[model samples]
Target: MPAGVLFMFIIVFTTLVAVRMNSYVISALIIYVFFSIIGAVDDIAKVINQRKIAKGLISKQDYQYKADGISAGLRLFLYMTISLLVAMAAYKYIPNINGDINLPFISIVKRFPSLPFWLFIPFMTFTIAIFANGVNFTDGFDTLATVPSICCFVFVGIISFISSNSIWSNYLLIPHIVGLQEILPLIGAVIGTLLAYLWFNSPPSTIIMGDSGSVGLGGLIGILFIFTKAGFYLPLVGFIFFMEFASVAIQIGYFKLTGKRVFLMAPIHHHFQIMMRKSGLYKGEFQIKSKIAWRFHILSVVCLVLGLALFLKIR
Candidate 1:
């Protein structure tokens, strides 16, 4: 089975079980499943194209599957649509949420009053799409995304549980979001699934989670933050993913304007790997071979720890 399919099954099964325990989690899971389906379809199309090429049924130059499986426009439309639906559902079901924007690191808990539905829907849709694609972009290397994801979800789960408990919310000066705690099991399920996926996806990866897994996982984290009123803290916890995404955007923008490559590669991690291989920073060949991925993973871990500590102290 494809790694994407295996991941989908595990998460879907876990979501189903979690729904039985807390039906509210189903809304978030719906967004996750939608992104996963988009990813799976794209993956399947890519596989078909690759198989055709291998069998001499299609010319490599003639293959369009890279761009044909689903157009970027269509994917963006779908992402926006699903995000709007989730936002609307939150509006209807969760009283007072009203798309409040919460800021991080003020002595007092600050919330910007709700935006109109029209503005809120599009604004939130854009935010979620950024997160989904940011994580998708970061999935380029083994364990590059998995460790950060695990850390984010674990902490988000803690935040959710705390936010749902009025006493804890009062003590921490965070909003007490009623019924948000029900999502804890769902978060737990994702964390567990990611842990299993990491076993196969670590260095010398046996299989990759692919875009499907990455986008779905990212969507889950994004929605969880929105639900828990911790959207501001997302940048803190998801700093690595945002950095990866930003590097690509910067590289592209600079190249388009100046016709010069910013880095040997984009997404930053690949740039590190390329630099390690080409720069001869290390005299030992074996050291260079091992250091690239290891260094990236170490940095990821450090960021995760920092994010966790920051959230705890702020909360």
Candidate 2:
């Protein structure tokens, strides 16, 4: 069973019970479930392909596309289209969710650089699509994506709490977005779901949160950043996910341009794994993986703290 199935249920149930079904939470849940459905389609396709291969009904080489889940091209198309629609909806329906954004280290008074709709819509769509893939890429390792995701939600929750209150927003010099607090329960539910996921996804994981969970979580996080007007802080709050995504992009781009590989493998974590294996310092796969997981977890924590301090206290 795809772990995302459980994640969906838990998040939905927890959020609904913990908070009133306000417009903010309702919109968030709808957007989250929409992206999750896209991911679930890919997951289901991969499972069907695996079963076919196991039964010798289809050759693995011939069905390689299916084995890898939905084709990358199709998945990208879906991501772009669905996220664009979501962005449009947010702009049209959500209050105070305009092109204005919050920047780190800048007073919110000066940071409200209002962008034109054309640019803002595409930017929002790009953010949602990119982070969805970023989390998906980071999910390559056990428990790697979970910590960072939890950290991100924690940041979003704090920012939302601050943004919803006039006094705190004024004190912090952040935007006072009405109804923003309504999404706190959703953020809390997501954090709780990830923590529950971590219990099983710790090193030597029994169940992996495949693309279904990763993509959904990533997409939701991206939207949360926008909704909270903290989109600029994504690079800091989601530092690990950004690095993972950047490594792959750099490796591929560099290889195509110069016919040279940047790392032993794409995704910095895998490069580290290959390096450790080559160094003969680690005794086995478990040790190398454990080291990587712990290091990334610590990095996520540091980024979370720095991001919060810079956004809230550094004024």
Candidate 3:
């Protein structure tokens, strides 16, 4: 079985055992499970395609037999559908959370309030989809997604605990979210599973989490942000994933509009790897050493998380 399947089981079982289910947590978990299902379907399709190709059951030139797991349109449709369902459920079930958008580092008194439900639904859906794909794109290297994700979950789990407690929420000048504390176990479960998976997924990986894991994890992170009213912090907390997605977006947009490529490769990590090789910093044909890549990425994530935490504490 794919490691992702095992990871999902771990998440579900741990959440069930560790946290009492409430409407809010249940809705969030449902969204996470749905995203995982989409990923599993895609993984299955990819594996099947690979098997067919390897067996010479299908020719590469056959348009219908293209090895790409799922068409972008189909995947987008599924993502949007899932996002809409989750958004609707959140709107109906999650209390003390509405269309208010809080700006991070700003005074708690100020917020973008009373955003119409129609507008908020689409916006929330877009947020989930963007984060999900951002994570999917960032899973290019071993531990690239896993370790940073663990950091994100840890930080978010802390924030969730703080947000849920009225005393801490007032002291921190953040929104007080009732029942948000229930989601902490889900966060803990994710952290535990990722740590276990890291044993085989670190440098020179024996297994890859692939889309099934990355997308699901990303969606869960997005939901956690929404529930805790910490959506703005996502850019800071998930800085690496944000940069990876942004690099790809900018590279594609720039190349198409200016007839020039921004980087040797899309996704900044791969670009750095290419640069390291071309600069003669590494001896191997692969310029980016796995150890270097892992260390650099991990350090970047840790610094960002700690910096954000300190800023939040002192501000």
Could you tell me the TM-score of candidate 1?
A: 0.88
Candidates by lDDT, descending order: 2, 3, 1
Please state the error at residue 93 of candidate 1 in Å: 2.7
Superior by TM-score: candidate 1 or candidate 3: 3
TM-score, predicted candidate 2 vs. hidden true structure: 0.94
lDDT (C-alpha, whole model) for all candidates: 0.75, 0.86, 0.77
Better-scoring candidate (lDDT), 1 or 3: 3
Error of model 2, residue 42, in angstroms: 1.9
Candidate 3 error regions (>4 Å): 58-67, 110-114, 285-292, 299-307, 310-315
Which predicted model would earn the best TM-score? 2
In candidate 2, stretches whose alpha carbon ends up further than 4 angstroms from where it belongs are: 62-65
Candidate 3 has a TM-score of 0.90
- In model 1, state the lDDT of residue 287: 62
